[model samples]
Target: MVCITFMSTTAMAREAPIFLVAHPDVATRGLNTDTARAIFAMRQRTWPSGQAARVFVLNNNDSVHARFAKEHLAVYPHQLQLAWDRMVFSGTGQAPNLVRDQEEMRERVATTPGAIGYLEREYLDDSVQVISME
Candidate 1:
């Protein structure tokens, strides 16, 4: 039993990083890096994501989203933590929708069309084009 459990653990550890995707069409027309930053920062309201500019989170453990947030959004996870803390404890911009994994993010973005989120560079298919950071 212990050996089997360990094998399963190793299998899951080999899993790939999450990839965020969006419809290729929405990629050009909707938020670019700057606009995405603004949207993530709550500076810009509304987007191709019907959910008040869906700021897709690449799983809670994703470093990619953190890097993007710091580099483009110019904010750290702590800021978001505080923001959400306030929003939940008080009230303001609603909390971002949580997608369990990259696949879910892709599905959400593909169906909604307005949603924007980050994904692993590998998961990007012709379905969604990556918005280059400026």
Candidate 2:
């Protein structure tokens, strides 16, 4: 029963759709789940087209960020934080840029070049273009 419960939780994370969004000017085909995961994990520094990728995220405790992780990246919030901490401490990579909330996420992504972030359908607008998952 415990094993079943753990498996279901992992499966549910993979089953959710995580919508990826980017600044309007960043050019590329839609990203596959692996690439998106790499970017958010701070492993991939550029978009597929070779343009620098400026990754952003809300606070780890934010509900939207939590959903984005479980659904989009299929990782838990603590896992991501640990990954970031490891990278930063080792001088291997920098942590993703952070924003306070969805409102700030929209503003920063809209203005920053090569920016990538996520938002719910309702918070989306003309300022950014949604990047479809491949």
Candidate 3:
């Protein structure tokens, strides 16, 4: 019974459509997948419009984090962690700022200029802009 419940909850989270969200002040409304991937991977430091990009993320183990990683970014959570780890260890870059949950994800993205993160539809509000991924 417990196993079935956990599976279903995981299934539901995977099914939820994740939106790429950014601060309202970010100039671009859309980004190519490669650029988005680079930003999240800490390889790209600025938005196309030349704004310094600040990336936020939920905990690596969070279901929403896994879903957004695989479904939207075409990468796994473990892979992202490894990339972040490599950057941190080599002093080339740093890990993204971690938010505790979707509420925090939305709040941080909304408040920070050039911020980028993902959220489910329910957590979105006027303070952030939904960025379309091509």
Candidate 4:
């Protein structure tokens, strides 16, 4: 029998915590499983203002988004792709904001009020609300 092991060098190399940054006006913080599921699922498609929700996403190469998606969003990357496709074909809306990395996502969300996204749970800050995963 042959055995194989897979490892991610970036996972080990992430020296700082990942933060899901957002705009300043949002009045929410501290995420639980429910909120996480809602935002990530695109079920809550719009902000209270009626503006469509802007869910930012990190690159698939990033492990942090995967962990958050599986734990809180209840969906994997494949599911996310299917979701994007469904929305696109239906003309309901496109996928959430796609940021090349966490930093870009945070910066984008920070400036955009309708924006919502996830990063490593620990890196969140007061600049934005970290919706609960409950």
Candidate 5:
């Protein structure tokens, strides 16, 4: 029973809710899944308001990165990586900036104009704006 409880708790942690956060200066309040996907995939270069969009991300192997890609962007982390790789190889685009962890993600997104990233709920604060994804 104790082992089962531990496993369940770990699973819950892995599935914790993640929010799409951006620099407070970004004017957009919400984004569709497709637009969000494009931005994270480095296909879209600017926010709806015409501000240049700068995307930040955790390492591809991070659990939070995996969860955000799957749940919010509707793509796997591997698929996103492949898209980024193709862009870089083709010299058409650049990959999102990689942050070390949620703390760094929050700090970068909060400070950089038009920056966007995802964070688990506990890391969210007024320093950034939560952009609803639908």
Candidate 6:
């Protein structure tokens, strides 16, 4: 049992310290990177469980946003912007909600139902639930 516990703990610790967080009301417990990318890219509007997903993000120039895009989503910030722009122009999709900073991101995501956004470990609080990445 001790070995099992240690293994589990170590496994969980291996995840990036940054996280995908959501309003407490969202039904999802976790998401894969592809699903996260799809949501952020505005290709998917709803969660896998059919809940409406209100996506949020920091400014494209924000270091957190850039890191999240590259390290988490395996994409570039400009690529995501271009995709959002193309979708907006073509009438197929809309951009994610933009927050001015991590503080605003925490506030908005904590209050908006079905909302999802990324944040560093330090910004976490009880208002938002961390969505473990699959």
| Clashes found in each candidate (C-alpha, N, C closer than 3 A) | 7, 0, 0, 10, 0, 0
Compared with the true structure, the alpha-carbon lDDT of candidate 5 equals: 0.93
lDDT per residue, candidate 4, 86-133, as tens digits?
Answer: 888899867766788766776788788778876665556666666543
Q: What is the lDDT of residue 24 in candidate 6?
A: 96
Per-residue lDDT value at 3 in model 5:
50
lDDT of 5 by residue, 1-134 (tens): 35543456775655569999999999999999999999999999999899999999999899999989998888999999999999999999998999999999999999999999999999999999999986
lDDT of 6 by residue, 39-75 (tens): 9999999999999999999999987899899988999
Cα displacement (Å) at residue 59, model 3: 0.5
What is the C-alpha lDDT profile of model 2 across 1-71, one tens digit per residue? 35543456666674334468899999985988889989999999999999999999999998789999888
Q: Considering only N, C-alpha and C atoms within 3 Å, which residue pairs clash in candidate 1? A: 19-119, 19-120, 20-118, 20-119, 48-114, 49-114, 49-115
130: Cα error in model 4, Å: 2.9
TM-score of each: 0.65, 0.85, 0.90, 0.69, 0.91, 0.86
* lDDT for each residue of candidate 1 in 1-134, tens digit (9 for 90 to 100): 35543456656765444333455555344345666666665556675444445566664456666665675567787686667667766666666666787777777766665567777766666666565553
Q: Who is ahead in lDDT, 1 or 5?
A: 5
Clashing pairs for model 3 are none
User: Relative to the unseen true structure, what is the C-alpha lDDT of residue 88 in candidate 1, on a scale of 0 to 100?
Assistant: 63
* Alpha carbon deviation, residue 66, candidate 6 (Å): 0.5
lDDT of each structure?
0.61, 0.88, 0.94, 0.66, 0.93, 0.91
Ranking by TM-score: 5, 3, 6, 2, 4, 1
Question: Which prediction has the highest TM-score against the true structure?
Answer: 5
Q: Pick the candidate with the highest lDDT.
A: 3
lDDT value, candidate 3, whole model: 0.94
What TM value does model 5 have? Answer: 0.91
